[model samples]
Target chain A: MEEIQFWIGIVATMAFAVTGVLAIADRGVDIFGVLVLGLITAIGGGTIRDIILEIPPFWSENQIYVWLALAASVATFFAESFFTQPQIYRWMLYIDGFGAALFAIQGATKAWMMGFGLPVGPVILGVITAIGGGLIRDVLAGRKTLIMSHELYAIPVTLGCSVYVLILNFTPQYAIEGSAFCMLGIFAIRAAAIHWDLHVPKMFITKTR
Target chain B: MEEIQFWIGIVATMAFAVTGVLAIADRGVDIFGVLVLGLITAIGGGTIRDIILEIPPFWSENQIYVWLALAASVATFFAESFFTQPQIYRWMLYIDGFGAALFAIQGATKAWMMGFGLPVGPVILGVITAIGGGLIRDVLAGRKTLIMSHELYAIPVTLGCSVYVLILNFTPQYAIEGSAFCMLGIFAIRAAAIHWDLHVPKMFITKTR
Candidate 1:
């Protein structure tokens, strides 16, 4: 189970790094800036989660995550041109959704294990862990943050987190399975939203007076 | 001692809230967004500091900070027009410099109290606590962060924190006096920079290719 968690984390880190690179590709940021952005995007969410949980940041404890993120970022910086096709972009989105799902579930589980109990705090932590890196990346790249956008980004993560916490509360024995189920659910919703161009409704938005 | 720290924190919170409001006032964000930006700017740095030190976030433990920040934001929203005078703006800058200085010293002292030890970690935490809130505010408002700009914003905080940590390491009995000295130093440098429109030179800048 620990090994599975480790690999999932690594994959998520790499996926987010790619997303970061994609975000800043045409922004005229320098190579060093690009690497920094990728590192921040890959590690930012989990770093915030660990800090809020009063644990040492995950990347600080183990150099593997940092190294992997750096390597993935360097790769993406050089190879971003190859992924400009619409099909490749779509695939990247799908993979990003999958990674977000995994991160959301893992974050909720970690918070639960830390005795944050059911529902609110754990669910929020989960969402933060899933999207915090992307939010930071967007803000740094001078683009609209996912939370501020019309896109259906945070909702799927929120739903997955809430469900994961609920399942954990009711059936502690099925924790691992429940996590997997929640991840799949989140990924499906996010992928569908991407495919259909779904967005939060205008009525839900707060307008400037 | 605790009382002094509490009051200093409150003043800093209010000042940062005002700064946040000023940053987003003309950006077309609504009332709710303004409040969020203000609250985050006021508490954001301290929250980051506590998290890094594995302590409960300060605002979570005390509602006074939250209320004060909200009040400041609301007041700024309604009363901002009255402060358009250049004199008022200059006053705000001076107050902000003082708040930043106070925040820097307090953050270093808190980290030292928490056993973060001499030299590196505490000093870094100090600087983060001093500027983290402002950085978040600027990023959210889609403006350049202070650290990324030519402004001499972060240098004073860094110098003050380094001095505070060094003083604590050598003469523990002078901790309080050392903090005072550091705060004064930070405020003086920041004030001078604001007055003279000082900035980092072009030679130190990294250009994007």
Candidate 2:
């Protein structure tokens, strides 16, 4: 389980780096700025999660994460045309969904291990972990926050986290399976939302231009 | 020394809380959002600093910080028109400068005590602590980050932190005096910038729309 999660984190780091590059696609941020943005977006969520959990920042313990994100960001910068393609943007959306799902589960697992218990804290942590990086990227880019947008971004992650908490609370035996089930469910929901042009319902949205 | 620092922190909390309300002013965010933003803007910086230093969050030790911020935010909400005055915005800017100065010093003190050494890590931590909350507040509110603008914000904090670190390294006996001196210097620089419309100069600026 530990080994699998480690690899998931590695992949998530790079996926997030690419998304960071995409976030600043046309604003004329220089190369140095692009690299900094990449590193920040990639490691930001995990760093925040670790800090909240009172653990050493994950990148500080292992430099590989930093190097990988830097390298991925540089690669994206060089391959600007590939990223600009419409199909590639759609592809990144799926990769983003995958990373968000995995991150939410990882955050919940850590919070649970640390005895945060059910429902509120762990679920919120999960959602924060999942969306925190993207939020920072958009914020730094001066774009609207994901929560403020009409997109179905936070909802899937929230539902998946709640389901995981339910599993941990009621049926401890299926907890391992529950992790996998939740990750896939979150991803599927996100993919469906993107495919269907779905949005959060009107009641939840604030009226903003 | 610790006693004085604690009071500075309390004042900073209320100051940042008011700035947060001003950030969302005229945006039509409801009462709950205002309260939450206030609490977040108040504690977010110190919380980040503590987490990075691997210490328990400051608010976790004392709930008074939380209550004070909430109360200040509620007061601001009730007195919305008073806050809308041009002079009130200017006053908040000075309060922001004062709070930023103190928080930067506090962050540097913590990092130095933890043996982060000269000129690099501690300085970065200090700046992060001073600006982290405003960054979040502005980002969530979709405003440009302080660092991105030409405002002389981080520069003063950075110079003050450098002075603090230098005092710590060279003349350890005057460390407390150095703290006061640096805080005042930072606030003075920021105030001067606000009063004179000072900027970071065109050479250092990136061409962004």
Q: Check candidate 2 and list the clashing pairs.
A: none
Candidate 1, residues A116-177, lDDT tens digits: the string is: 53345578578878888887888878787764555677777887888888888899899888
What TM-score does chain B of candidate 2 reach? Answer: 0.92
Q: Candidate 2: which stretches are off by over 4 Å? A: A28-37, A74-79, A201-209, B1-47, B54-127, B133-143, B150-209
- Model 2, residue A143: distance off in Å is 2.0
Error at B164, model 2, angstroms: 14
C-alpha positional error of residue B93 in candidate 1 after TM-score superposition, expressed in Å: 16
Model-by-model lDDT, in order?
0.80, 0.81
For model 1, what is the error of residue A112's alpha carbon versus the real structure, in angstroms, after optimal superposition? 2.5
Off by over 4 Å in 1: A1-7, A60-64, A116-121, A166-174, B1-39, B52-54, B59-135, B144-209
| All candidates: TM-score of chain A | 0.92, 0.93
Complex DockQ, candidate 1: 0.13
Write candidate 2's Cα lDDT for A6-95 as tens digits: 887788788888888777756655454566578778878777787677777666657677778889888887787787688987888788
Most DockQ-accurate candidate: 2
